[model samples]
Target: MARAGGKWRNAWRKSQKSNLKLRHTQFDAALHNWLLVEDRKQQRRQKYRSLPHSIIHSFSAISPRDVIVFCARKKHDDVAAMLFLQHGEVATYHVGWSSAHGRQTNAHYALLKHAADHFVRCGVTRLDLGTVDTENAPGLARFKIGSGARVRPLGGTWLRIPGL
Candidate 1:
């Protein structure tokens, strides 16, 4: 059997070889046109929640360059990847939305490949792929897992009430 992290590393490496072009932009007011167009296109995506401009703006403001807006371009820009970075410590893979054509061409893999390199260059060692609904989103789980991230259950939510 292969080493544990080996497979994930391999997938990431494969993403690098793919010829998909990448553009990294700091999400800012200057991105008005991009934000509008991307939001509009992302809304029509099936089985995905539509992202709003306000939320995008808020995230961008909160993290600045940490909120990396990655777009994978082919002949045209076909897919976008949303990554939230905690500077050098960790970078979270928030979301990745792609058109049908983008998916058909496996643009995400290429995007991630570039992301891994970028993170390393920026001194980041961790990439959190967030939650995966195994039952409802097996494909996503497989994708993340196949990319080399280990799966663990998130800590449960708890509340402490005073004078209860």
Candidate 2:
């Protein structure tokens, strides 16, 4: 029920001053070396892939900071949520993970927002947010749509392995 409205904006402002800190890093960077490293490590991950990493790497030299991590610090920096994407002409959402505490604190929301802003600054004009299957994952569907993303049909070519 956390729509990107006035209430959410207020919470975002409050969270900035709160214990949670938003970070942007490269895809290859370590998750531990944040503000402070936390002990109790736990998370739930989700992955989506249209092409292999090798394919993406072929286009550009893989560098650091293509990732966004939302860290919540108490005694140490705890990774509340993290998101990774593949970039070309369009930046594609590759994968993401979030902890139970992250869900409670809406870490993914902040993470995605930060990432979108980062991508735009990097000259990326398009960001494909991957699939939104409401029949299976309704919450995820709503989340993506609620972020001002409209549904677009994906166009692609299917080919059989030549030898097969």
Index of the highest-TM-score prediction: 1
lDDT of 1: 0.66
Candidate lDDT values, in order: 0.66, 0.56
Q: Rate residue 133 of model 1 by lDDT.
A: 72
Task: Point out the worst 10-residue segment of candidate 1 by lDDT.
Answer: 1-10
In candidate 2, how many Å is residue 68 off? 6.5
Q: Taking the tens digit of each residue's C-alpha lDDT, what string does model 1 give over 5-55?
A: 565565545545556688777666675456456656655653555335566
State the lDDT of candidate 2 residue by residue for 7-111, as single tens digits: 556545555555567766553434333321221121112332334434323333444344434344333545464445545546777545555666666666677
Score candidate 2 by TM-score against the native.
Answer: 0.64
Model 1: clashing residue pairs? 8-148
TM-scores vs. true structure, each candidate: 0.71, 0.64
Could you report the Cα RMSD, in angstroms, for every candidate shown?
A: 4.2, 5.7
